[model samples]
Target: MTAGPDPVAPGRTTTSSASTGELFGAVTRDLSTLIRQEIELAKAEATQSARNAGRGVGMFGGAGVAVHLALIFVSLALWWALGDPVGLGWSGVIVAVLWAIVAAVLALRGRTELRRVQGLPRTADTVKKIPHALQGHEEENS
Candidate 1:
């Protein structure tokens, strides 16, 4: 069911109708602006987060290099210790074989850990549920 055009507006063209449409148009334009602003805000936040992550990764790399230098000294000490039992060449070969085995084990474990990672899965699931939550379709029947 619908109401007929206002009698005062005969052809449905009147100042009041035009004003109402103008209001609707204004609201639509404002909504579009608001959505664009929100998108820009999100983009800015994401950019900041990426910059932070890059800095963090670089810092970690620096730390890793420092640790590697420390490990080199430690390995040299271990080779010197074994030098008493075996000759220099055999001691170096033994250390090399031990490092090879350790590298293989670490590589396998690191691969497994990387495979287990699911980036932002919980956030993704929560975002997916937002529309349903906004529509008042909360869990009831389960």
Candidate 2:
């Protein structure tokens, strides 16, 4: 009698046929793409946040500079108006130092916020599904 087609032949190509390696590769590619997209999204968000932070810091710095200059003017005016009762130089120096401290605090806070936006957790979460997806694909293909 003629032999019928073998079911488990290694090179057989059934409708559901795929090698473990191929399935793994496909799943890997898909997961890599997903991770890449997620990373890109995170990077874009981080960049936007950085831009916003930069703008905010710039504005804060500018306002602080303006306030310092204003304080200098006010101190000078007060010194002149009070007939130099209190020295304007000391008041200007104190206001300038206070403004510097405030600016430094704001910059540190911004740096902390940016650091918290790192993308590793999101990438790990997405990568965690890759093995399961590959296993399922392997079973279906088998």
Candidate 3:
């Protein structure tokens, strides 16, 4: 008697499926896409950090202009007031020194804000794990 067709196993695909090369190609494509997405994420993070850095630099520029204007107007008033007690030249020097202190404080504040900016923390963290994942050591690295 002829036997019936072999029964297909449960939870398994037919042997007529894709070849090994085709499966490898699919994995390669997926991996390439993942790498590209990671690169895009890194670019976005860099852009955000650059904007924050720009803001810090802008604060420095604003401080310089503000100090220059204050020196021109407010320093004259201060110098004139001190001119009575001290000579005009010494009073001018005192006003100039005060303005210098104000400029220094403004510059320090801008530097502090710049230091607060963090660059690519998340991106760097994830990138470090990519090699481990590709090597099939993801669990160990994690």
Candidate 1 per-residue C-alpha lDDT over 1-142 given as tens digits, one digit per residue, 9 for 90 to 100: 4455668746554444456776677667765775576566556666766676667567756877888888789889989999998987888999898889977996786567546544444344444554564456745222
- Evaluation by lDDT, superior candidate among 1 and 3: 3
Which predicted model would earn the best lDDT?
A: 3
lDDT of 3 by residue, 78-111 (tens): 8899999998999999988887897799779767
Q: Assess every candidate by TM-score.
A: 0.50, 0.51, 0.75
Please state the error at residue 18 of candidate 1 in Å: 4.9
Residue-level error in angstroms, candidate 2, position 100? 9.9
**Best-fitting candidate, scored by TM-score:** 3
Alpha-carbon runs more than 4 Å astray in model 2 = 1-15, 83-142
**After superposition on all CA atoms, what RMSD does each candidate show versus the true structure?**
8.1, 7.7, 5.7
Candidates ranked by TM-score, best first? 3, 2, 1
Window of ten residues with lowest summed lDDT in model 2 = 133-142
* List of clashing residue pairs for candidate 2: none
lDDT of residue 100 for candidate 1: 93
Write down the lDDT that model 3 would get: 0.80
RMSD of 2: 7.7
Candidate 3 lDDT trough over 10 residues, lowest sum:
3-12
